[model samples]
Structure formats: structure tokens, C-alpha cells
Target: MMNPFELERYFARWEFTAPFLLSASDTEPLAMSELLRLASPEMSDAWANLSLGYTESTGHPLLRQAIADLYTQTASDEGGEPPHAISSDDVLVFSCAEEAIYVSMRALLKPGDHVVCLWPSYQSLYDVARSIGADVTLVELREEAGWAVSASEIEYAIQKNTRLVIINAPHNPTGSMPDHDTWRTIVKTVEGSGAILFTDEVYRLLEHGDAVPLNAAATSSPRAISLGSVSKAFGLAGVRIGWIATRDAAIFRSLETYKDYTTICASAPAEILAIIALTNWSSIVSGQEAIVTANLKLWEAFMSDHESLFRWVRPTGGSVGFPQWLGEGSVDEFAENAVQEAGVMVLPSSVFRHGNPRVAMTNNFRVGLGRKSFPTALDRLGSHVRARYG
Candidate 1:
């Protein structure tokens, strides 16, 4: 049987037709011209004579090293440190973070395998694994507990034959993240169980304010795989270069074969741009963070003004968060009608919520704080919420 149809696309279907999109997962994207503005003279010179030839299926050597370097900084930025734990050889670039998830699932899972994943995850996390014939279990995050996962619950969810464990932090929708202590607990749990961990870390670079970023790349167990890319943090979604880092030589080898059957290689020019983006990573991200920080104030004021109609657990990091929309009628209908009447697009929680009734979240919606137009978008969203719910 085929995998279940993705539910987020229900809201996304109107993306092009809608006037304002507040649910986008990426920050404001950079135009090639804007990207050129960040490039050094040497990088600019390289782009001038760019080649269109097919690149290595895994990734360019320089680009791979750049990704490895980011993880190195992730740990040491808090203090002085040495080389990154995961080497460039562990990196395998993909066309986008989405593609990396797909190829990893395809190459690794077998029929009848058991998988444990976080609830309210990007649908691909569980759906794709389920499609491969794995029996999936979801370990939910408690919204009352600041949207953090329970390591004990995770231990309870896995079956004896559980083959994989998935962790997504700076999580999508609610944007929950495990603090460093909690993360280490999870790592020990997964490692103890001897299950391969597939970490969706696409949002890793979006940390702000007291957000202690964890390094899945520094996983001591050779079984953990980290997924990351330039889309969210660097606002280069159009470039579509992402990668998976695994110290496991076998996993990397298998992914290479699976990738060849699919995208084979990222676009050559995207690789060139990715290198330039990384070369100036701190500058690019700091500017993006400033936009998010400012927009967050707008989010704070709007939420404070409309607490009767909506409420949310503020995200620690990343572009998106899940917020409860306490409207009177069916939330699905409200979402649809809002698009028709208000010209705003946001993803309802049903797209992400998966678990039992007690824990299954409803009446919530996902919104992005990273857009340049979020101030205007917030106004549109407020008008709709007031008219429809109040």
C-alpha cells in the first residue's frame, strides 16, 4: 500500500492562490542577487565562471567540510573547543532536507520493523517510515510541560524489535526543543536500546535566546544520523542543498546507492551558492535572527491582545510554532473559511498531531515568525481571528 496522503498539503494547496501566507516554514528567502551581496570577492569570482556539469553524488568536498564545521561551532561557540566530532566523510548532501529524509528512510528500513517517533512531527518523519512497512509508535511532547519530550515515555514506546528512533528538536509546529540535559538523557536512552537514531535537525541553526542547541552530530553511538540544510536558517530554500551526517560508513554507502536512484546529485550551482552561504554563516544568520526577534515582539503583542481567542507555547528557536486557536466552529472549517474570507494561510494542527485523544492536539495552528512580511501577515491573521472566533 502507498503511504497516507500528507495532511499539511491540504492547507498548502491554497498557497499560490492565497494573498498572505503566515504558515511558511522557511524564513524570507534570499534572491541570487541578495546572496551575491554576501559573497566574498573570491566566491563572487567563482560564481562568475560556474560549471553546470554533474557533481559528485555524495557532495562536493569543500561543501561537505563546511557542514561539518557548523556542527563543530555548535558545541564550541559556548566555549573554546577543537575540531568537530563528525568528519566531512560523514556528510552526504541532498537536493533539500526533505530529500535527505526520503533517501535515508528508503535505504535503511525493512518490512515489519518498528519505529518510534515524536508526535506532531513533520508528517514525513513517521509517514514515510510507516510507508516502508514499519510499525510506528509516537512519543508525545507535553504542551503543559513546555513542549518537551519525556525520555521515560520514549523508553516506554519502543518495542523490543524497534529498529529506529527519530528525534526532531527545535521541533516544527510548537518549536519545542530539549535542553542539553534532556538531550543527553535521550541520547543515552536511544543508545542503550541500540536503535539507530534518525535526527531531523533541519531547524538546528535557528537557535535564539537561552536556546541550548544540541549536536546530534556529536552522537557517540555510531548509529545516529543527523539531517540538516540551509533552507530554514540561511533562507536559501530555492538553492535546495541539504545533507545527512552519519559516522556509520555502511549507512552512508547505502544512502549513496539510494540517492542515485532518486535525485542522484544536488544541482551544481546550488552547491556553489551553499558554500558561499556557509563561508558567511554567522553574518547571514545574525541578520535573519534579527528579523525573527523583531517579528517575535509583534507575535508577543498580538498573542497578548487575543489571549481569549488563541494561546501558544512560545518557541525557543526555529521559524514555526503550534498555537491553540480557540474558535467556536470546526477548526478545519475555520482554516478553510479563513483562507476564503481573510486571504491568510496557516496550517491547522490536525496536519501534525498524531496520538491518542488525551494527547492528540486539536484546535491549534502553525505560524512562522521569520517572514519579512510577518507584521502585515499578523494583522491579516488578527482580523480573521477576531471576526471569526470572537
Candidate 2:
């Protein structure tokens, strides 16, 4: 039986009803009016005259070209080859990054295949492989070391039959990022083991400040594939447009074929919106970065004030944070109480637990520094902790 994503399972139950939601990975989503202001007037006119029919399953050519350009831009920003390039044909657009992940994993995995994944990641990385009856090995990130991953740990997990390895960099929950050196080591490890690397870079562009992101993983090896989306960094979740960008023609063809069983193509309207979003990318990213910066400041002050109750290695990139419950019972129980009693909802790390015997299940919870309501949610959380556990 296939295991469903626990986070989505939790959200399906409480997301709509929860009064204080602090667990979302996305920064505050942009409204259509704000999006229009960022885009050119011609884009609005295009929306007005949009056709309501099936577009190319590979994606609209213009949309694909814009995404290819972004990968080129990412390569340049991350200090890669001056001739950095990926063709629009190398990209396969999907409904969302989550679907991109599923499509990639499903296309690559087979019965009896062996897969290794970075632990405490977005569940689909490991669970999807497991659900396919593949042997899934998880290598844990060092939590106390600011989510640092050692090459030895990853190398140790690799086996002769290892078919795939996945990494969600600028990672989820913890928001920690790896340096260029780490990326090289990881690439070397996977290459040596002869396993394809699947890099999830959906959160890569959300990096705040001057910290440069690693080059797209697809560029590291012919077998490697990278995923990107318009949701997180650009705050355009409504568009629900995401893609798989790769240098390998075989991988691109495989996923594109598998995508037929899934959502055949993105909506016509969303494709137009995605094209407009990418066309106006700089302004969209900058606007969301400003929101992330302000929210981070508030999160910092709240954690500092409640030192006895919370402690964290502040994030270096992305908007999610994992904070320890300093004075508490089970953090899972505390989080539920906060939601029900204080109307504050923060994700307890329990939901992300992978059965890796090497890693101790943490008593930490994901604290999202993405929403404008973060301060009020923190306030309610602090008050509840003081009353219940202080």
C-alpha cells in the first residue's frame, strides 16, 4: 500500500479551519491585482483573450523558453559556465512542483530498485520510491549542526544497486542550504555510485540576501534532473505552474510520457499567467523577498524573547524554520494544544518522521517565517507555552 503525505493529510483536516496557520511553506501568495501590476499591460490583454482549450502537454513554447532562460539565469547567478544553457525542449512543464516530483520519481523507479534520499525532506522524495516497492534508504541531515550533511553519511548510504538519490536543497522545514563544496561532494558521491540524482530546487531561489545558490543540479551530471516552480519564491501559487528541467533527452522524454497518466497539461489560463510571471520575475521575487525579510525579523524577536521556551539555529535561506521546544512535553502534543487552545498552528516535526534508526526523532517543529500573521501566531504560541509548560 502506498503511504500518503502526512503534511497534506494534516492540512486536509485543519488547513481551512485553523485560525492561526504558521505551517505553510509558501510566503504570502500574491493577489491577481498585484500580479497584474507586476506584469506588462499586454499580458492583461492576453488574459482577456485567453483560449480555453488543451495546450501542448510539453508546455507552451513561450512558457518553456522563459523557464529555460531562468535556468540559464540561475546558472549565471550561481557562478557556472559562461555558456550555461538548457533548451526549452529540455524542460517539461507540470501542474505544480509536487506533481513534478511525483512524475520524476514514478518515471525513474521500478520494482526492486534501490533509492537513497535526504532525510526530513518533502515526503514524496522517499515515500514515493517506497510506495513503488523500491528499497528506500534515508541519510539524515545533522540537525544540531545547522542541517549540515556530511559526504561520509551520504556515501555510507549508497549501495551497489542504488538507482536514485534525491535532495531537497535549501531544504524544507529547516531552511538550511549547502555550499558549493558540499554540492560537489554530493555530485561525486552519486556519480561514483552510479545513481541518478534528483535535485529539488523549488526552494532554491527563495534564498534571502547575497548568499548565492548552488547551480542547478541538472548541470552537474547528464543523469541529474532539477525541478522548479513559480509558487514559493515568486508567491504565485495560484498559477500552479511548475517544471522539470534537465540536460538529458532520455529523462525529459521519460517524464513527459509519464505525465500523460497525470494532469495532461496545465490550464490554459495558468500557462499565460506563468509566462507573465516569469517575464516579470525580478519584481515578483523582490516583492516576496521583502515580505520574507520583515517576517524573519519578527520571528527572530519572538524567539529571542521566549528564550526559555524556544531555541533555533536561524535559517540562512528560505522562509521555513525549525525551532526546539525548550520547556515542554511532547512537541506534537504542545502543537495541537497551541492550535486548539491558542488558535495557533505550527507544524510539529513528528509529521516528518522517517523511520531512520540512525537519527533520533526530533522534538522540533517547523516555524514558517512567511506569513504576515507569523507574529500573532508566535505570540499565541508563547503564551500557551508559558501557561502550560513554563
Task: List RMSD in Å for every model shown.
Answer: 2.5, 2.0
RMSD of 2: 2.0
Using TM-score as the measure, the top candidate is 2
Q: Residue 75 deviation, candidate 2, in Å?
A: 2.1
Write down the lDDT that model 1 would get. Answer: 0.82
Backbone clashes for every candidate come to 2, 0
Structure candidate 2, residue pairs in collision: none
What tens digits encode model 2's per-residue C-alpha lDDT throughout 1-390? 666677778778777788888888887787887777766777788888888999999999989999988877767434444434788988899999989988888998898999988888888888888888899888887667889867778888888889888888888888888877787789878977889988888877778788877888886777788889988887778789999988888888899999999998988999988998898887777777787888888878877877887888878788788888876577788788888988877788877876333445678988777776776776777787778776
Stretches of candidate 1 off by over 4 Å are 76-84, 218-220, 353-360
Candidate lDDT values, in order:
0.82, 0.82
Error of 2 at 259 (Å): 0.8
Alpha-carbon shift of residue 334 in model 1 (angstroms):
2.5
lDDT of 1 by residue, 131-219 (tens): 79889998877678888878889989877888889999778877888876677678778878978888888888788785667766444
Provide the TM-score for each candidate, comma-separated: 0.94, 0.95
